[model samples]
Target: MTATRQLEGKIAWITGGGSGIGAATARALAEAGAHAVVSGRRAAELDRVAADIRAQGGQADTLPLDVADAGAVADAGAQIAATHGAVDILVASAGINVPNRAFAELDTASWDRIVAVNLSGVMYAVSAVLPGMRTAGDGLVVIVSSWVGRHAVKLGGPAYNATKHGLVALGHSLNMEECANGIRACVVMPGEVATDILAKRAAPPPPEELARLLDPSDVARMIRAVCEMPARACVNEILISPAWNRNFIAPGEAAPRPARAAT
Candidate 1:
């Protein structure tokens, strides 16, 4: 198959498709001939992504969704299946992190919100698509985790760290239970990407630092490559990071400073 059409005739549903890695992956998959269905809380952003794909002469659709909402995610999944057939690929990339990531500053509310969007939300999206994949006897799931997911890091905060780590196990469990059904799951753990999520950090990286970080397209390309692999082969995990991994910096030097106490 030609590289440009490797995913021809496939259907891919990408959560968090409005921006960052999700948006980049949508474009990549579409260029490869998959009908891309982009979803996220921002309807306008999703529309923009879809429009850009169509402008490039590719099939694209948009579904405004809040992955944290179980009913909404399920409905969106059902709607897509009815309108476009079974989803051949699912990219669960919706995630969030708060500025108050330090355990000393992290609150229950923040913890719950992060878990809802990052961990439980992923579970919902995965569950929504599994039935169709099982019936088709072929499917690929790419869970966009983080390098912190595999290695604990103070910079990622407790909630974000916990949820990301959960994704690794979740992806593995899916492969163990569903491999016989011809379903493959891969957890992509990436170190520091220069995405909007960075703005939520206690201290956003400087331009010089951002330049050294991975770009959304970099991770997207990896995801697309995984999607192109034959059904007989399965990539269980991918750990990708920029050459200048900040995680390697001295612990105290890299950790975000805790917010100061209120007067």
Candidate 2:
């Protein structure tokens, strides 16, 4: 079968599917012929993504809820599985990063919230969907981590780094345990991307700098590529970024490189 039909009739559940990488992945999966079920805290945004998929002649649905709420996350997965069949694909893209702060300046509340959403939320979603996948003996999971996941950085803050790092470990462990059941898992560590999340940064980068970052669609395409792979193979991890490397430089501190003339 062609890539377009690889996921025909499959059900894909994506958290934070209202925008950014989540929204882009939803579109990508839908186009590949899967029924995209998007979940997020924002009802309006989720509806918008669903509507966009439908407009393009693809299947789509919306579920609005906070991933940080463990009970709610589990319930949503259960309900979705019952109503639409087991989720053939689960993209745990819901995450948050507060403004960067020094370790001494970090407050307990901020750290708790980040861990709750980024770490607990991921585990909750995975646990909720794993049963169905195991019983069916097949599934794919894509966790959207970050470049900060594998390394320490001043701008990522302690909470962000810790949570992202946890996700990497979680994905690896999940892949190892579930491979026998025909379930595959991949952790995507992305560099700076142009998305609304940047607005939450302690100091948002300038427009020019942000423009140099990777586009969410780029990551979405990678997700599609992974999902389309033959069941015999699995992608364990991927690190994607723009051709220009700007993540090493702190936001607003680096000047844009001048464009070169065409040969």
Candidate 3:
């Protein structure tokens, strides 16, 4: 017998679903029986993902809009609710980072752009869907944060670190306020996932190195696991890292190992 699809008939709205972790998660959710609505700024990319999902016999639709535009996000949310009767899940994964820029070197415009999309954009999406969630009496929200939020990493710019750190706090506050209303919130902190974002790095990793990094599909599986959990339980946060931590070693240097296993 086949396992029952846990999210059958549920509606999932994922921002940044055009690519990276968001796109992977959308596909996973669709496979699990949710009607996945993917939204992103790239119309072509969004259409590609949606089309792929449909080809795989999954339910999907695409919405093209910039998350940085609050009005547009709100309008899209309203339209989704009107058409789909309120989204049952929301995965906020839209993010960007400027590489090789420190606090002293980063410009005001770049900082503003990062904050607009990574921080305020998350808040905007949350604002858009909360009313419907409140009306429905239950919902799930997954915030795709970064390990930089919990620990400082020099490679990620100050703006990226600051906004991601803020997202962790945002997730907690959201749960604190909405738990009574049956809104479950989770923050996923991923370390060095191999995705297009890496292309923005000052020195992009070669294909061989990128191959060792965590796949977006890995994170997508985690998202599905969190969503499939019983309503009585909610995983508040998770940190996922690739076993081979590229950042832990310098280029062309051999990784050190312990002489013996410690208890």
Q: Which residue runs does candidate 2 get wrong by more than 4 Å?
A: 1-3, 249-263
Question: What are the RMSDs of all candidates, in order?
Answer: 7.5, 2.7, 2.5
- Model 3 residue pairs with clashes: none
User: Alpha carbon lDDT of residue 178, candidate 3?
Assistant: 96
TM-score of each: 0.94, 0.93, 0.94
Per-residue CA lDDT of model 3 for 1-263, tens digit only, reads 13357999999999999999999999999988899999999999999999988888889999888999999999999999989989899999999988756877899989999999999999999999999999888999999999898887988888999999999999999999999999999999999999999999888888877888899999999999998988778899999998888767777754456589677
Candidate 1 vs 2: which has more lDDT: 1
By TM-score, highest first, what's the ranking? 3, 1, 2
Overall local distance difference test of candidate 1: 0.94
90-140, model 1: which lDDT tens digit per residue?
999999999988879999999999999999999999999999999999999
What is the lDDT, from 0 to 100, of the residue 169 in candidate 3? 98
Local distance difference test scores for all models: 0.94, 0.90, 0.91
- Where in model 1 is the C-alpha error above 4 Å? 1-3, 250-263
Q: How big is the positional error of residue 218 in model 2, measured in Å on the Cα after superposition? A: 0.4
